[model samples]
Target: MPPPSAPDCYRVPTTPSSGEFRDRGSKFVAVLRPVRSEAEALAVVEEQRLAHPKCNHHCYAYRIGPGTDRWRANDDGEPSGTAGKPILGQIDKEGLSDLIIVVSRYFGGTKLGTSGLITAYREAARLSLLETVLAERVLTSPILLEFGYALMTPVMGALSQLGLEMADQEFTERARIKLEVRQSEREATVKELKAAIAGVYLAEVHDTFVVEGLTVSLPG
Candidate 1:
């Protein structure tokens, strides 16, 4: 098989989602939320813990950033791989990042085997994700361009023609415009802008972000 395409876009929940799964009398409630960082993800988990203080366990999994390298799965008090691993598996299966899923379990006077616990947590997470409204987020990099006031007209015209938005602008001795360009289009945009106006200073990209766009559906 050919190599997979680089991930320029990803799916993320538009709002919080909740679902429940009961097996062998044990109840598992899964809550899914969009998060941009590990700190945010942990805060969500803490909120759930406070809301369900009597629960027996609070297992969770989170994935951050564009690459799959930044991720974590916590079993909490459940068996080694039964809770967190299954929950994370569902998230990965849906090809989503920048999100977290937490499964809270309430003991139902019965103990579910390792396999049963895995299935229950996985099902709960899947159900929660299914109820969520997702959006396709495109990654963008910030570009700062500075030029003399004499070149303002041509620079603005070039930016408008290229369909780029100005995030910020300043008027001093020179004109400085901040633009958010899609990562894939950064190179071409810079080249075109330079060719359109002389003495255009294209600064190095220091930050990137993902912005939500149209709604998207995940494969079942």
Candidate 2:
């Protein structure tokens, strides 16, 4: 596991990808994508259904939010745990979240039974990941800092030392500055801010947001 000092990011697919597998006579096409919410994931599933209206089934699994706090797997008329579970297993195996994998099956007039179905779905999902591109998303926390005018020099020096730029600033009897700190830097940044302000200052850390397009390939 990456330490807290590491980038507070997670792995996710940046674009959609698909893979297929055949079993007996059935064709399974697995579509994998990153989705922001359960609503969006369901919408993608609907789109897949409409695009393949003739398919025998549309089994899927989706995990959303950090830690995969919300998730679901649907067998979609297939035997319990055969289709959806295996597909979800693939997603989990990749340590991915906020993603969906939907496998649409077109009956080829042969039944491979339960175990075969599981293998087909799992293989298709794995293949999708093989063709998928991955990215490390960066998370940012908004912080508000206020300090007495007397300490502007030290505060500015601290900001410079930390390579933190103010998102917004106000100067009056006291000064207030807003910043966007990476989640990984929050604790250390707070400590530095306190040290700089000394006797008089306020630093408020706010909710986090994803840094747009600020992606990297995290090292293992």
Q: What TM-score number comes out for model 2?
A: 0.77
Please list the residue runs of candidate 2 whose C-alpha ends up more than 4 Å from where it truly belongs after superposition: 1-7, 148-157, 167-175, 196-220
Q: Give the distance in Å from residue 190's predicted Cα in candidate 1 to where it truly belongs.
A: 1.8
All candidates: TM-score: 0.84, 0.77
1-220 in candidate 2: lDDT tens per residue?
Answer: 3222234787778889999998888899999988989999999899999989999699999988666568999999999999889998988888777789999999998888988999999998889888888776677777776666666777787788668898888888678788887788776666556544443333432223222221111122
Alpha-carbon local distance difference test for all models: 0.80, 0.79
Give the clashing pairs for model 1.
none
Q: Write the per-residue lDDT of candidate 1 for residues 176-212, one digit (tens) a residue.
A: 7788777787766666665545333344221232112
By TM-score, who's the top model here? Answer: 1
What are the C-alpha RMSDs, in order, of all predicted structures?
9.4, 8.7
Best by lDDT: 1
Model 1, residue 64: what's the lDDT? 92
> Which 10 successive residues of model 1 have the least lDDT summed?
210-219
